[model samples]
Structure formats: C-alpha cells, structure tokens
Target: MGGRHVLRARRLMEGALDGPDGLDEEELVRAARAVVAELGSPGRLSALVAELAAGVGDPSGCARLSYRHVLGFDKLLLVSVGTRHMLRAHVWHPGSHRAGREDIHNHRSALASFVVRGTLGMELYETAGDGPLAAARYRESLSAEVSDWLLEPAGRARLRLTQTAEYTAGSGYALPSYALHRAWCASPGAAVTLFLETGAGRRRYTDVFTGDGRDGRAQAYAKEPLEVAEYLAELRALAELIGGSEELARS
Candidate 1:
C-alpha cells in the first residue's frame, strides 16, 4: 500500500470496523471477501484506488494504528492485495496474548498470517517451568520465546529466535501450528497480514482447567466453540471448511 491507496485502505479499515461488535471473525471474513470482489473490477476499484492512494504519500514507519481498542490490544492495520487467487489483501493487526501461547490451557490453533510491509518477528515458544507468569513477565518473556522453540521443543523454559528477512509491502509468510508462533512488528514500520484459521483443534477450553490445576474461569482464551455439546461435530465442521474430510479429521 502506497500513498493514497493506503489512506483508502486505512479509511476502509477504520471506518468499516469501528462500530460495536466490530469485525468479529465472521464480519472480518465477509469484509475481506467483499474487498477481494471489488478488486476484480477496475471500474469499481479505480476511484477507490486513486482516492485511497492519494494522501498516503510515502511509506512512513509510524502511522496511526487502526485497531486501538477493537482487538483488545495495541496494533496498527495494513493491507495487501493478492494478485493471485482471491485478490484479498492480508491485514495485519495486533494479536491477543493467547494468539500463539504454549500454556496447558490452550490447545492449538492452526493459524495463517501474511505480512504486507516492513518486517515481522515470527516468535515461537513452549512453556518453561510450571508456575503462573506475572502479567508483565508473560508479555516480554513470550516475545523472546520465539527463538527458544526454533532451536528445539525438548527443553524447559528455553527458546530459539530467528530473524527472517525484512518483509516490505506485499511480502508475507505463513505460520503453521507446528510452531507456537506469533508475529510482531520487527521494524519501525507498519504492516498488515491476513489471518485464516480457527487455531488448534476446537478444544473445550472452558471445560478444562489451566495447566497448573488453577481455575481458568477468568481466562480470556477459554474458547467455548459453538458446539459446546459435541466436540467431534465442531471439529469435523471446521476441518471440512478447510477441505479435509471428516474421517481424516477424526483421525
């Protein structure tokens, strides 16, 4: 996104996602699909392109973050247009603390993130020792754990951090569930990445307790999927959406 185009993207993001119940999983996907569809018609997106790209001027590292409170985190949003299949751009926004956690409370979430600009720090981790982490400790510690997992997953409280090349606008990457991965801004630059995945197999987060046997009642990541009744049904439904068969999902 350059000049006016980013401005337009920003406008669309800010203006479109600001209301209550803001772009939750469903709305976000719906908006993304619409943006992709519009990109197909030059006649439709031409004016938008011009207006959006207008004041964007040049790429500045720091820009207003579109998601101040929406994500319940601090993050700026950026866009990317895929010339390939869907024409949908990856919009990178700040992720929640549990986005790539290694705690016992969290199962796994198969996630996909594609960067749109500058560089992104792909962090991976595993639980170190068996004590609850201080609030501040969790954030900073997890931020560094990316390296620990890259080295090996056999150790305790250990991690591996590897710096991939800086990703400029249009460059992106994917994070499979294999690595307890999460991304952050690596440069003084802004970025956007598209996220697609339900994360891990739909675990009965609310049904389980934390790793340390602590009550996880207050846990935000305690996800109770739609099928609070049958885990298999919910799991199979998600697998089918991604093209996997139910038999394979059961496996």
Candidate 2:
C-alpha cells in the first residue's frame, strides 16, 4: 500500500486531468490553481513532508529528481505521474547573491504555481519590432543522455514587456507552455511556491532570452540531483517552516 500523502497527490492529479478530451488551456489553468490550493495548504503540506521524510513513499526516486535549478531556486519534486503531471515545491532565496536578472523563458509544458510563503513577482513579454531592448535568443533543449540543458544561440530578438504581477501567499497563477515570462522572489525573505506541470505532449524545446550578447556558442548546464539525506533534510525544514507560518497566521 502507498502512503496517504502519495495517494492523496495521485487523486489530486487525477481530478485535474479528468476532462474527457483532456484539459484545454483555460481548463488546465483552473485545475492547476485548484490543485495547488489544496496541496499547498499548511495541514496537507506538513503531512506530505512528514510522510516523505519518514520514507513512507517513493522518496528516494523523488530525491534523485530534485535539484537546485540554474534559475536560482531549490526544486523539490513532490510527486511525478510520468510526463502527464508533476508536483513540485520551489524554494526561492532572496538577495543579489542568488543570481543575476533571470532570463526570460518559457516552459515545455503548461504550468501553475501557488505561493506557500512570501511573494512571487512575474513579468510577461512578447516579441516586438526592432527597438532598444534587443536580446540574444537561445533554443534550450535537454541532452538525451544526461538531461543537461543545452542552450544554442538562435539569433537576436526584441521583446516588449506585456504585463507585471505579484502573487502573495494563498494566491496562485497558471500559464500556457508557450507563454514568455520570467519570475523572481519579491519578498524580503525566502519564498516557497508549490508548482504543477500538466500535459503529456511536452514541447521538445523552449525559448530563452538573455540580455548580454555572447560569442554565439552552445552552452551546457549540468543538472545535479540531490541525495536521499539532503532531500529528507530539506523536507523537514520545509515542514517546520510551514508549521511556523500556520501558527503565526492563527495567532
């Protein structure tokens, strides 16, 4: 028998993907928002963490997939149902030491995120006619063998900022796979968000835009997975943080 948390996560994903013909963009967004709301709740989140920390589920596999993303955040895979759906926790650190301005990029699959703590700021963009904000564009794909990120120069493009928004705890948002956007922690302290990616037919590549002009060479970033111990420690810390936050809210 599976752990309660694992079973609960599977049920949530099943409900989200229950549409007869699968989920459209709007439906996917709605499902993602609803699912995250439940998963990110303090009680449920704490229970999930506790269960995983106790090795009651597939924590080892989840740990192997967890890593610190190049975009300056700790990405912990909570549950993965093949390529159809995935649930993750993103912990974003504050301050300049974290990383420089993030590159504007899109994902291979439609995604949604719910802020569990602190705030998240996001900006949406679109390609524009030739202007001052010209940026170097790259087509990012994963290497077949190691899953390393391979960024190949794809020429220059100008982008126009379409929208800017901030989401605080208890709020969430979703976007299609092709949406061009960037996000960062907007609070004074570390921020945590529960993220969900849905859709089996993922795109092979994603677009990444960087401001600095480079030598037009393909760049590769290796993905380092976490060990079981580190994963458990992180989950413990996450549980404590959520418990503390809940107490504060109640008080």
Encode model 1's per-residue lDDT on 151-247: one tens digit a residue.
1122123333333344544444443333444445565533443343332232222111112343322222211222212322322332232233532
Q: What TM-score would every model get versus the actual structure? A: 0.32, 0.92
lDDT values for all models: 0.33, 0.83
Clashing pairs counted in every model:
27, 0
lDDT of 1: 0.33
What local lDDT does model 2 show for residue 128? 86
**What stretches of model 2 exceed 4 Å from their correct place?**
130-132, 244-251
In angstroms, what RMSD does candidate 1 have relative to the true structure?
Answer: 18.5
- Top lDDT hit: 2
Worst 10 residues of 2 by lDDT: 242-251
